[model samples]
Target chain A: MLKRTPLFEKHVAAGARMVEFGGWEMPVQYSGIIDEHNAVRQSVGLFDISHMGRLMVRGPQAEEFLQHVVTCDVSAIPLGQSNYGLLCRPDGGIVDDIFIYHLPDEFLVVINASNREKDWQWLHDHTEGFDVEIVSRSDRWAMLAVQGPGAEALLIQAEESGAGSLHDLPFHGVALSSIFGYTALVARTGYTGEDGFELFFDAVHAEEIWDKLVGLGAKPCGLGARDSLRFEPCLALYGHEINDDINPYEARLGWVVKLDKGDFVGREALVAIKAAGPSRRLTGFEMVGKGVARGDYPVHTLDGEPIGVVTTGMPAPSIGRPLGIAYVPTSLSAEGSEFDILIREKPVRARAIKMPFYKPRYKK
Target chain B: MSHNVPAELRYSKSDEWVRVEGDELVIGITDFAQDQLGDIVYLELPKVGQVIAPGEPFGVIESVKASSDLYAPVGGEVVAVNGDLDASQEAINTAPYGAGWLIRVRPSGDEEEGIMDAAGYAAFCEDRAH
Candidate 1:
């Protein structure tokens, strides 16, 4: 049985097409993927991201425990700041990509829904020696992201809490603000590569806040638009881009892995992997011929030799072109390299290109 | 929501509609199919004079969500193709039965006899939607 979010009935009433995603019956589209995607790019769009796991880690050893588990330097971030990081297995394979928010008393680790249980177990197994309390707030808290070029304006207009100027909040900053008569955690972070705010509040206020935002001319978007928006920015999905077998180095996320930081999970293996150099690297490619190269499609060389596999492929709605991310041999990872994506057992012409297929227009 | 099924047209189980004009038949995907496909960006149509077998794939239509094969409702030689779709594929979503017509074929067999009529096709679509 698939779980439903707090806004399930709201989505159905809005004529949204619901599909099972990450063990949850989520809305894939409301007013069509293209329209919702365009709304996020040109105006503002809202999303129900309540399915994401929220873990609260508190205690004296909180920062120390987090630094040991995550690849990013969590200790470097001050209070009310967030940093994107990755959790890895001892074998250097990614466990999951996460965003950690540093609050006044505790750290909030937001993770992908599909990896919630596995990540909790991984973190639990490593907490034998640390004096920390990891509490799962997955059911108690609901998340909503208001994203796009005009996101700040919509948020400020919709916020009824008399909160101070939200524009003053720097990127990746977080604040405890009163919204809709409830205390809400507003973070200047999002996966859409646009200027946005992710609001976290009690699950009971989910519908009220969502309705307030929508009433302010914010388009209600779904998972379909979320995927397209993130894809254009070349953001990695957990299972597709950084699974248990795909390391961060090969995923072009070496910057997140602080090898210089003293001792962490997967540190030794990553050092060895880095020294050996990744044999296969994830690269972006654009379809020069026809057809969308979907996930798991075989990528072949110009001479018909199979080199790599496509991770995520789709028509980039923002760019108005078909683009994909694939893992190919390091020799073929350069831009302008020609290759073929086997769609329906037939090789289709494609060429390697720079990623972030569409340049994100984020407000700095 | 209910789909639009014209009373004069015959339909295939794959959501394609066939309109017979004497010996020639005009083929296009139904409004239901286009709505399901959503935002079609490209259409691959068979060439004029190309012979197609009944129920055989004549071309492919791609949307941002999925790619669907455009099958021939009946065996025939393609006499006309809608080249306008090459420039504006949104016709499939806007005017699927008219401007979005995929191909015109001269029948070589009585394949239309096995197809469902308007009422039967509407029932079929309603059943599948549930």
Candidate 2:
């Protein structure tokens, strides 16, 4: 049986094309992916991201435990700040990528929905000697992502009914707010690379908040648009781009790994890999011809020798061109390097390019 | 749903449809499928004269949103392939049941199986909608 979110009825009423995503029956699109993607790019869109996992770690040892578990230094983070980090296995493989937010009394970690159970168990198993309590808040809360250029304006209107004004929140910041007469945790963070707010509220109040946002001109978006939008921004998806078999260095996420912060789960492996260097590196590519490069497509040299494989690919709606990310040998991973994508046993020319095929227009 | 599903064509559960044209069976994705996929941007059509087995992937169609495999509805030898999709790929999104026809194949002497008639295809879509 598939799990259902609080907004399941809302999605049905909106004519959403439903798909089973990570054990939850969620909308893949409503009006359409392109339409919803464009809506979030130009205006505002609301997404039922309650499927994403949320965990709270609270105690006198909260900051100290997080500093030891995650690769990033959570000790220096002031209250209301959030930092992107990764949980790595002992051998440097990524367990899961997460965002750690520092609240006054506790640290909140938002992780991928698919990895929620695994991550929760991993955290518990590793916390045997620690004094912190690792609690899963996913079932108790519902999340709504309000994203786009006009997100703040729409959120302000929704927050008028006791929801706090979102005006003071900055990027990567979190605050307590009220909406629809319910207290909620409002964070100015998003995966779409757009200025937006992710609201964590009581699961029962999700429908009312969803309707209110829709009534305020926030188009209801789905996983389809969410994928395209995040793809355009080069944000990494766990299963597609990063996984347990791949480490942070190979995924080009070395910035999120802090080896100097002392021993962590994967510190030794990351340190050795950092010293010797990664054999294969993840890089971006653009199809020079008229074909779409998809995942698992062979990356080959001009002479037809296999080099690597594409990890993620799509026709970017924001750029109006075909783009993808691939894992290529270090020698050929440089920007402007030329390669070919083997499509149907035929070589299609592709050029290695810098990531973030689309630059976001964040509010100043 | 003004989109038309011609009575002469046969459709597979995967949304591919086949119609007899001269000595070959012409195949394309259904109009309903195109409408759901939205804005066909690129097509990976199979090469001419390739042998394809039933339910095997012959090509892929990628839109701005997702990628879907184009499967062979019946085992056959590819006699012809759609080359026009290389340039004006929107033909699939605009007229999927017609100009978007993906390939033509000579049957491997087997009777058509697992195909739905026009009325059956419409009902199949209706069943999926619920």
Candidate 1: CAPRI quality band: medium
lDDT per residue (tens digit) for residues A249-344 in model 1: 999999999999899999999999999999999999999887888889999998899999999888888788889999999998999998999988
The collision pairs in model 1 are none
What local lDDT does model 1 show for residue B91?
90
Candidate 2, A61-170: lDDT as tens digits: 88878887898878767899898999999999888999898888999999998998899888888886678998888999998899999999888877745344578787
In order, the first chain's TM-score in every candidate is 0.98, 0.97
**lDDT (Cα, tens digit) per residue for candidate 1, span B4-46:** 8999999998888999888899999999999888889877888
Docking model 2 quality class:
medium
Q: Model 2, which residues run further than 4 Å from truth?
A: A161-164, B1-4, B8-28, B44-60, B69-116, B124-130
lDDT of 1: 0.90
* Model 2 chain A lowest lDDT segment of ten: A157-166
- Kindly give the stretch of ten consecutive residues in candidate 2 chain B with the minimal lDDT sum: B107-116
User: Please, what are the lDDT tens digits per residue for candidate 2 over residues B1-130?
Assistant: 4457889998999999989877788889998889878778777777887998888888888887667888888878988888888788888877887788888899985534668899999888887766
Task: Evaluate every candidate with DockQ and list the scores.
Answer: 0.65, 0.59
